[model samples]
Target: MSGITTSFFLIFAGAAVVASLALYTRQPLIIAYIVLGAVIGPYGVEWVTDLKLLADIADVGILFLLFLLGLDMQPRALIDTIQKSTVVALLSSLAFASLGIGIAFLFGFTLVECLVIGAAMMFSSTIIGIKLLPTTVLHHKHTGELMIGLLLLQDLIAIFVLLLLMAFGLGEFSIMDFSLTLLSLPLFVAAAFAAVRWIVLPLLRRFDRFHEYIFLVALGWCLGLAEAGHALGLSAEIGAFLAGISLATSPISQYIAVNLKPLRDFFLILFFFSLGARFDLGLIGEVLVPAMVLATTMLGLKPVIFRYLLHGLSERNSLAWDLGFRLGQVSEFSLLIAYMAAGSAIIGREASHLIQATTIITFVVSSYIIILNYPTPIAISDKLRRD
Candidate 1:
């Protein structure tokens, strides 16, 4: 218990100090959190060695993040965005996946390793993309809609990739298993919608007057659906996202979304911290060359590919370029896939390290580029910063 207390103290205290310094230095606060994790984590000063506990808690950040995203958009808008962005998302995913596969093969990795790495490369960082976008821009701008739609589509693909990895992990990668897995997704989505329509929405309608109760119920509903997803062999993230989408039509959705931002940030800080803490710094040297090559390639290629794809879809050149830059990074999901694959012995440590190092590098570099060249909430220049 004391250890847990000490860990929390270190995390918050470190975050406060580092975040302040980041603000002063015009750096992304997210980098501060990750650096804090690496500095005090087991491999560093060994101040917070309980990596599993931190990781479990940190996952809630992603859940709430998705939940808020759903609340922000109406169901119709979400559907429209998905419909419009599907082609761009699919094309960009294929391009990035091929790049990853080719690079991994060039480095002498096995076919399975190449495939896993390729799948991991198909996503952009939703957290970074959304968190930095101003709320006003997100709600009113076409760029935001495109970014959100593309990210959501990518997230769906990531879920399927994760499921495939899980099936492989369990040694059940048969044709029947794959078909059943695909079938379960639609069934689970149907069940989620049905429950929301019949039960959850009614409860919310009846209890709307009670603010505290509304908050509690909303939280419970989110977590409950997340657990249900896990039970049904889906990720908790997908479940939480569906929970938010189900509530998007309700009048109280805005209130819930607003109140939950602080909570979401809290968990996200922990998530980033755990991400850094879990990384084995010793393995970095072994994968440094490949990681640099991969990171540089991704940073260069993603923007060009996305810009061309969005332009082909009739988006304005300026908007397409901005959207491309915003998404020009490997995702946190990439790290999750690498972690799971390595843990399951599906990929070697070197492959895992390559993914981790490249992700971190891209994250850092992408943040700098976006803040410097585009409008973000945390831009250094007053002219570029938007509320």
Candidate 2:
């Protein structure tokens, strides 16, 4: 059996077990996924070997994730997302990044290492936030809207950083190159959007009559555009997202989503499992103090910064607190940032591993915290409002 095939079986078996446990305990299944990964990983009973193919599939998972996010977005929503959440995301990200870098500096990490650590800490996991959101609440409340907005902001920031990293070479950064790269974003997006509308849409519309054809067309558009984006020095995630958005108005969008769910789930499991198995516990051990320091800062300080941002926007303290508590954990994109930075050699393996470890720890802890306290926080807000 192929290594990737074995890994998929293991992940599927793990997910099934976690699903049962999550149902029994009334907890999120995502936590179960992480815990399962840890249990069957290199640190545990060694089962799977080949990770390269799984890693590649995980990349597809990321593309689908971005695509789904875009599918949920509407053009009219951008103004509101930016106005409500842009400043909040930015301020929160800056505060977390600063705290992360400061802790790294205090722990005697190099300047480059500190920079990478800080940058990695700036993003929060849109995937978790979106997946965990109550669909009922999302369709009803201001808080849900704010959460969605915040996630969109974080996604944009992550994409920009990815673009920057891709544009830069092995040597030090260049102002001219950076300027050119930034200028190219809108052009690339515009061109992609235009091509999708004028060319891709017609072909997809015809193919929509056949279920197999619809699925193939959707996948082809996503992958084809992703490849085109890579060729043009943009992240494939960007193209995949745009592809989803382009198809959002089509009647076949829902069909595509339904068809893609199993594939997405399968690959996403690989993505998360690979994330866990690839972690360098040795480096984490070496940088134990720094890792702990950074984790503490994220857990302690991020919420406070977000609370302040919310309060500044005239939100009630209690509501701000709920929002803060919900967003306190570092995002999944933080891992992606670390992975990219490590791959690019912008930071050492230890620094990247430290960030990833902190992220996983924070994600597990924060998910529990929010799940437990969500109702209490909302109730407290209502009490405060009445008072």
Candidate 3:
């Protein structure tokens, strides 16, 4: 009875109870998912220790999330925003990475540890950023366009950084391989759009009334290209995003987005829960002081840096500040980098755990600040809940 089936029961059942309590206490349900995971996870109650399965599914959630975002994108707008936001993304990432390196060095971490730690800090949480964005603002506003552009650029940079980390991990870096990976983006984009025109649109047009068929095709198209992207040395998220964009001009794109929402949410819960479940609270003491220092500094500093940077580019003070607060957290990519670094022996477990703890702290604190002060999909205040 306590096999995988029971684990599912525990996860969903516990989530329901905790989420209800969070609502009653005027807290975000995201916190409830994390708390439930920690309480029921291996390090706490010693349940659901085999996390590999759930983690795999969690990746799918992210793939679908990016795909959905691409589906909503107006390609021309995305291009213009990308051009405007590229400098912001690069400069802001450089600032955050420098801060991470300085903090890690001051804490007496080794040179390698400091570099890896700083590399991890160069992005923000895609899930958190996109999830919190109110749909009213997201699909229509200039701020939304700019935010998406900046995030996408950071994602590309994260992928490049990850490739270098992989090269370091293997003790063999290849210039040609790196060059090819960079070149693959446009080739893949062209291939995706071609497929949509030659294959997907025709099928959907022919079987427009068969809702189930459209669903299956959309899912297949997303995952199929995700795998394709991975084969081409690009990230699966990028591939899935391209797949979504290929269909963006279709009349059925909105229908596909609406239908996929529930499925996306179901998997996203597992993604957040898996985060809490994987964190070892017992080992946190080793990294606690540094984690607290890093987290607090990042929370206070990220918004200020972003606000000034965006404002310097001619964004209004209010808009720049809002974007800044919204992005003022360490990224999910930080956790991924920590994992990869530890796995590759580029950083020790202690350093990896430091990254995890710092990220979790930022996730929790940054979210509270955003929901309290801004309009979001899950704001505690009725007036602020714009979704």
lDDT of 3 by residue, 1-387 (tens): 857888888889888899899999999888889888888889889778778898888889999999999899988889999999988999999999999999999999999999999989889999889999998788889988988998999999999988899888999999999899899898888888888999899999999899999999999999999999888877888888888888999989999999999999989999989999999999999999999999988889989999999999999999999999999999988998999999999999999999999999899888898899999989999999998
In angstroms, give how far residue 15 of model 2 lies from its true place: 2.9
Q: Which is the leading candidate under TM-score?
A: 3
Q: Which residue pairs clash within candidate 2?
A: 124-331, 125-331, 125-332
Candidate 2 — number of clashing residue pairs? 3
What TM-score does model 3 achieve against the real structure?
A: 0.99
Cα lDDT tens digits for candidate 2, 265-314: 77777776777766655566686777677777787877788889999999
Estimate, for each residue in 163-232, the C-alpha lDDT of model 1 and write its tens digit: 8888889877777866776678788878878888898888888878888988998899899888887777
At residue 105, candidate 2 shows an lDDT of 90
TM-score of 1: 0.96
- Global CA lDDT computed for model 1: 0.89
List TM-scores for all candidates, in order. 0.96, 0.86, 0.99
Stretches of candidate 1 above 4 Å error?
none
Q: How does model 2 score by TM-score? A: 0.86
> Which has the better TM-score: candidate 1, or candidate 2?
1
Collision count for each candidate, in order: 0, 3, 0
Residue pairs that clash (backbone atoms under 3 angstroms), model 1: none
